[model samples]
Target: MRIMTYNVHVWYDNDGQFKLQEMIDLIKLLKPDLLCLQEITKHGLTEFVKQTGFTKVFKYHSVAILTNIENVEELSPPSNTRNYYPRFATVKVPLGDGKEFFLTCVHLDYKVETNRMKEIKQIKKHLSCLNADAAQVWAGDFNALTLEDYSDVVLNEITSVRRKNNWEMPKNDVSTTMKADGFECSWALVDRPPPVSTCRFDTHIDYIYINQDFRKIFEVTKVEHHGSTASDHSPVIADFKLIQTDDTEEESGDQ
Candidate 1:
């Protein structure tokens, strides 16, 4: 299976031009089996699906799913909080022949730490409800840099300073989403040749996480940082395979 995670920056390029149609074209070219998009507005989502022939999960929020393969069985919108937009969505897709997969698309809060924490908690709660046992892929613009980055006192201080200045500081931590003990970030687990910058500004924020139990079945075959003018944040692609199957059941597997 091929999957991608991208934060289109609402189809705005680094040059500050809004090219929603160009973004759609890029997604069509990738042709991921499942796609997780962030920063999508209602109009932009409609325009994307219309152009790329992908279906949008029925919801009133930014996160959307675009896939040429698989049938969408369920979609759960992000939990509502007073200060933040619904920037996350979860979908269950049937891979085929009774097999299925779970895809969670998320865009973390870009502002207050309190709000960011709340959003993460909400996301965890929703994922827990899904009973995601089959190959699960959680991807999108996390806004958080990495778990290591959160240890920097300077970064935390910068966040405090931004809060005082009425500027929203981006949360840079992976611990927020690791409520389950065995979850692992795909980029960190695989032996990446080296860190290739993804964002136009040369930052690595977007990511893909899979449950550790599924790691052996899915390998990070390829990961590319598209520096094209499609969107501010480059797209990430991952390939997976089913290595083992429980002989106990064939059709009614968990996803």
Candidate 2:
């Protein structure tokens, strides 16, 4: 499976140039089976669905998903959380031969670690409702740093900037929290070096994560930053290969 997650930066480039067609061209070249997009406007979404010729498109607020695959089932995020629609969206994609998996696309809080933390807490609550053995993936721009991406000096410098803004220092608890919950970052699992930056900030923040059940069935072939001048944030791609037969055990859990 070829899955991609991209933040279109509101259909503009980092230099403030409008490049919607360029962005479409990039997606055309890659032709991901499943694509999750963030920071897209209503007009941009219409243009993409029309030009890309994707059979299915789902949008909740600014985040949208495009896929050519058939029989894809849309799923809902927890409504109990405040303003959850824009921040989270989900779908169930059939893997054929009666197998399937759940995909939750997300764009977490861009500023304030506390806000991001609250979002993560809600996400954790949502995931806990799913079956323990179900294959699941969450991917998007997290807008938070991972501890592994920076040296102590660079990390401290970032912390200092937040301090000057009267913001609490970043403890990198988001990454740690997800890890503690058994979600594995696909980028870290791959043996390749990541791009210098996934966004204009020169930091790697966008990510793809698969749960233990997913790891049991597929091997991650590659994860890369698909470079583009169309958006401030680069698209992230992950390729997976089926390595083993899926377990057919039936389990009951919330969607």
Candidate 3:
């Protein structure tokens, strides 16, 4: 499966031109099965769906999902009031093998750390309720560059203070959604030269994550920072092979 996460800067490329059609053209060319978009205005989302013939789920402020596959199921929004402004959406897509996985597209608050922390907690709470027996992925712009111990947020609840040695998990690393407990970042697993900065205008943010089970099945074939003329943030593309699993295998394999 090929998935892409892009902060389209509201459809305006780095050239300071606002052309939604150009963005649509790019997406059409890539034909990603799943797309996680940030900073997409309602109008742009509508236009994208109209142009690309892909179904889409649009949150209020900075997150959206577009997919060509059928059977998209929407998950409940986070309960945290801190993020009244929509920042994420959880959607389920069919894997074409009688199996389905949840794909969560997120764009956390960049201005407020307190609010960001609240959002993270809310996301974890929501994940905890998922059918842990199925494959799941959370991908998008986290606005978190450092890789401090998220165990507290995911496991305990202790928040505050920065940890040394926890260089912000690189954008590519965090982008590959991994399980909170035993999963490792895809970028960390493979050795690669420095990533071309995704955020040429500001900061490099945006990501994708897949739990361990899915990782074993699908390898991250590529993670490229598509230089942007359409947004302040560049797009990250990840290609993977849908490792065929025997239907008879344990139902509760990965979540």
- CA deviation > 4 Å runs, candidate 1: 56-59, 79-84, 112-114, 132-134, 147-172, 176-180, 244-255
Residue by residue across 142-247, what tens digits does model 2's lDDT show? 8878877787898888778878977656668888877887888898898546574798767778988888888877789999987786899989999998765424
TM-score for predicted model 2 compared with the true structure: 0.88
Quantify all predictions' global Cα lDDT against the true fold. 0.68, 0.82, 0.66
lDDT of 3: 0.66
Error of 1 at 86 (Å): 3.0
Sorted by lDDT, highest first, which candidate order results? 2, 1, 3
Please give the lDDT score for candidate 2. Answer: 0.82
Q: Whole-model lDDT, candidate 1?
A: 0.68
Highest TM-score among the candidates is held by which one? 2
Q: Which window of ten consecutive residues has the lowest lDDT sum in model 1? A: 246-255
Backbone collision tally, model 2: 0
| Better candidate by lDDT, 2 or 3 | 2
Tell me the tens digit of each residue's lDDT in model 3 across 1-255: 888888888888767889788888888888888899888888878888888888556464567787767678777665546525557888877765566778888788765445666676667677788766667676787775533323335312212222233323223233333334445444444543246356752334566667765675677777666754667787777778766556524443643
- Per-candidate TM-score against the hidden true structure: 0.77, 0.88, 0.75
